[model samples]
Target: MAELPIEIALDDERATQRLGQDLALALRPGDCLALRGDLGAGKSTLARALIRCIAADPGLEVPSPTFTLVQSYDLRIPIAHFDLYRIADPDELVELGLDEALGDGAVLIEWPEHAGDALPSGRILIEIDEGPEDSRKVRLNGPDQAMQRIRRSLAIRAFLGAAGHDDADRQFLQGDASTRTYEAVTTAGGERLILMDAPKRLIGPVLRDGKRYAQIAHVAEDIRPFVAIGSFLRDNGFRAPEILARDLDTGFLLLEDLGRGGILDDQGLPVTARWEAAIDCLVALHRTDVPRHITIQDGTAHTIPPFDREAMLIEVDLYLSWYLPHKLGAEPSPRLREKFHAGWNGLIDRLENASKSLVLRDFHSPNILWQADRAGIERIGLIDFQDAMIGPAAYDVASLVQDARVAVEPVLRDRLVARYEHARRRDPDFDPVPFREALAIMECQRATKILGIFVRLKKRDGKPGYLRHLPRIEAYLRRTLAHPVLHPLHDCYTEAGITPSES
Candidate 1:
């Protein structure tokens, strides 16, 4: 479907540059933007702003390519700025490496009309016209997909302006396995905040019980869960990022910057002191009698979902669904699949009587920030707990000790677990043996799920980076399966050809 042209009024040069910044956030590799305007129409100014924003350096030198014809930047996403005004023939576009430029990164072409029919039809067309009294009107039209991205970027810019961050600069921070994206916004006052740009969650094909995978897993569908849970954590004395500004319906949030300190050292190895502190943080949290139903300061209510049998079972099924086929080159037989579920069903049943607390489903190194200057449990910054559930506290402990992204050594892992166990022992109701069994069970469950997830990330999402950690997860899974309680499922995994080798 063709997208209608979107028009914006730029009242000043800053607004023109802000459009460039929005374009920076919207465009990706293989994108080409053709700027259409007469001389002195601010095309070069917009291009410069985009290049500098992508470079994450406000002072970057972006000389016009009028004479050079093309100037390339090796920034986060490499970009090529082109001036087609000097082109004597249409064939000159090929010689200038337009295809090569679009191959590795994006392109911005000024005087695109001079290139004749050389431009790709998929390119985004932006036209700028001077208006009365130092104003300009810009119209942008592109492919439906590109238009969607452009619209989202414009919405985010408008949201930021409404939140009083109109002059803030945005730099891409990172993206996770989910659809959400994060940006580091530097306000005009030099304060850095995280701009969480999570649109409404995508609903996959209904898999079971008329629910999608996210719904079954209790994954948050919007920013409301994040706001409610973050507020709850802060009220209970944790360092979750404070919500500075929010547009809940739009899923745009300006959150307090929790700093870049993490539990890992410079070499990506676990820092013992930080790990110990994280254990203490979890200990304190587990000790607290947290209610499942929490009302935020805004009077919004959220009920923490239970990490129930169906959720855990479906999560483990990822191993059979993705990993088994990827490993064995075929689907498991119906008999073997049923056996896999039967084993996990029993394990999940045991959790019904296990110790319950708020489970930060992803309580690992990636989500944990080490705030060196803060005191006690507050030093551990809890940044990613929107999917918090009321479930066995042992699940979170297992997630931390068997850190998914970073390989925590055996000695360190045992020490951290022991520290947590020792601290939890202070609770009169804490039973050490049952907790140890639950930890082993949770370890097997998480590792099994991740084994499939890593492969799925490569096969489904085109992300091969996570596959490198497959061996690490296998090692963790192998260690966990050795526990006597997991023996029933060990054979099921072995038959499926994903049973981690003892070696």
Candidate 2:
């Protein structure tokens, strides 16, 4: 299909490099970029800039492939740079393993006319022409889908320019399991910040009451909730990252880069001191009366959603829908599904009447950072709270103690629980028994939901890595099921053959 051509003016070498960086964001493996230009038309410079941006190494040596014909980089996504100026025949392109390189990774080919019509039809074609002074006119043409991605990337570049950080160097950061991605932006003066590229979440198929699961589960669709909640946490003395600038509609944010210091040690094990500090931070947050509605700028108030019954049921249903079918090779009978639902309904009903607090749904090691320079709970930096909801206070405690990703030793879990309870007891209204029961219930619920989620991620999303954590989550389920109050849910698990022993 034909694509609408995009014309960009490169005023100098810097503009050429910036355009290369913008184009890099839209490219993926298996894509080919065909560069058509003369010897001094700045093709090599643009190719070098694109390679360095993809590699996230500004100083990477990207010598022209004029002599070698092709040079490959071991980037996060491998890329091959090809200079076809010396090719004598179209078949010579095949002799140089061009086909294999295009299959394995992205290809950037200069002087593509040397190959005649050997180039792929859908590949991006960029033509450069000499312009006034040191300027160049760059014309981009590609498939409709590729051009759409390039357009969005150009919009993101414009957003950065308006924020006065268009000249900052961007380095890719390790992203989480969600659709959101992050980059570390550093200015020329050594100032650093984080750029969050979170597109508005696409609502899934309508499930119940014409609403999708994200709506039921209180998932944040944009950056508004993060901005509001981060402000609330920072105002309450916690270390949520400050939002410097935001494009709420696009879900793009420039935020303070909370450094890499975290509660986990170098070996990825939990550090006792940091974990203790995180527990103190949670206690401090829960002790206060946090508002459900936060007033954002422009007098817009973002209201925190309640962890209602529909949401809890939809989460736990993952066990029957995904885990049971994938692991057991059979769907649960209607009787079993009804039993599971009834069992959870009772627990969630009780939880609704319990003391409510702001529950950061993922208060685990992955989201908690350590700010050692700060004192007390202030040393704990919080993140990934965009899914925050008004829920039973015990839910976040359960999330911390029985982390889905990290193994919290049983002894340490007990110690942290005791510490949290001790801190809460300072208030006369606090009671230990109900809190313990709530914790046990939440643990069981979270484990059950995660079992289904991990399986769905593997079967539906083709991400099998998450399946490795099933045993740990199953063990957590067993521990919680041992609680006398969770016996009915335990029976449901046994009946469905989802118990740890069965696995």
Candidate 3:
């Protein structure tokens, strides 16, 4: 945390000022600048000058992010400058995905006082004040390494400058399966809008196209079930955020932004409480009925293909090829591979009827955002749900218990399975044998899909970071199947030559 740079008096731009050309060259990658000033404070003037100098395009004037909110440049390095003075809302900054650009390189942020904590550190904070005549006082803040250079460059000058509830927009307690969630949003008019960014093309709650399980229902008319689900949760007094607007064409939703902290990140809590809240969020959804008139027929008819045995096997085979051989260092004999597939296929059939529950298909640690301030129902927020489906109750439980990103304690996994079963209507006397079977199979199902997805994200989309989590998926598969409960599956993995990291 370097200190902000000190100010040095400077005359009018024509007299004694740090020219933008020099400033541009001085500002290198990884620079985060804070520009402070009053109205007509010349902040924009300075920024524009810097932009031209950095861009080396003499006649170009960068448009303000005021209306666009953010203008990105494809220079030698990406430079994003934000003007918050006219920024309609604060949290909207997160939607801009500036966080992604934060570490990529330097960012020129102006009227930053309006953006607040969104600013990244390790750069300069400039303050500009209107002074007598055309002269101005500028105060600059920065790391010591750049302080003297900053002071010699742009002179620093000092300067400048949500709660709510709307019922029409419905929100769901996002606990599991919803990914990269938008918690809450504050509109420029001071309206508190809850937002979720679900691009049906990517991953989220509602799936679109033929990808109902992997995408979102972008069209409002088509999203009735999703909205109905949200409304029901909200009306039932479940703590879910509201969806304010949806760009169905693009699958982006402007919903309320829930605050930080969720069960996903809390490692200090007891296993019992963690499992309890997770089961509760699921039970609430199962109890949530679509309006009597809006029969499951319509929802069911238009529903994307069920996550059936075929789909489950398709997912499992990916692990067999991509994950197993790579980790185990050898391919399984043909007989073992055949048996593994057949056994997994049998397990998927068993999964089809674990007392059907509204499965949040990706319910897991990373999908949950827990809140510390919450008392009861408001505790765990769900996400990545656009993939919701009518799958076995154990499927969601397995997704949570055998998380791909983070491992849940085995104690917690056992407790949640019990809690979920007790909340079931038909399976009160359900055997853990079958449930545990479903859990291992689903864990196998989940890990395989994610491994393929991660490989795709990296090889195709050029996002390699997701690969780091593959080992966790591998570890879960080995553990879940290692139990005497799943020895059949475990032996199959070994006979199939999976995971040299033998149990």
Which number leads on TM-score? Answer: 1
- Model 1 error, position 38 (Å): 1.8
What TM-score should be assigned to candidate 1? 0.96
lDDT of 2: 0.85
Once superposed on the true structure, which residue ranges of model 3 sit more than 4 Å away at CA? 1-185, 189-228, 235-237, 264-272, 287-305, 324-337, 371-376, 422-433, 483-492, 495-503
lDDT per residue as tens, model 2, 231-276: 8998888889988888888878888988998888889898988888
What is the lDDT, from 0 to 100, of the residue 242 in candidate 2?
86
lDDT of 2 at 259: 94
Q: For candidate 2, give the lDDT of residue 502.
A: 16
Tell me the tens digit of each residue's lDDT in model 3 across 1-503: 65555655667863222344335645667777777788777777777777765565646768877777678887755688777777667787788777766667667777888876777666577788888888888777677876755443222111000122221212222321233223232333555554443333343344233554332222123344455555545677766667655544333455555655556434544345755887787776665553332223234433423556555665666556555555567765687678777777666666665555566676766657675677666677764454455566667777777776666666776777777767664645456567666666666667656776776556555567778977676676666665444454666656534443334
- Sort all candidates by TM-score, best to worst: 1, 2, 3
On the 0 to 100 scale, the lDDT of residue 106 in model 1 is: 98
**Residue-level lDDT for 78 in candidate 3:** 66
Which stretches of model 1 miss by more than 4 angstroms?
132-134, 297-299, 495-503
Q: Residue 10 in candidate 1 has what lDDT?
A: 95
Q: Which ten residues in a row have the lowest lDDT in candidate 2?
A: 494-503
* Candidate 2, residue 415: how far the Cα is off, in Å: 1.6
Question: Clashes in model 2: which pairs?
Answer: none
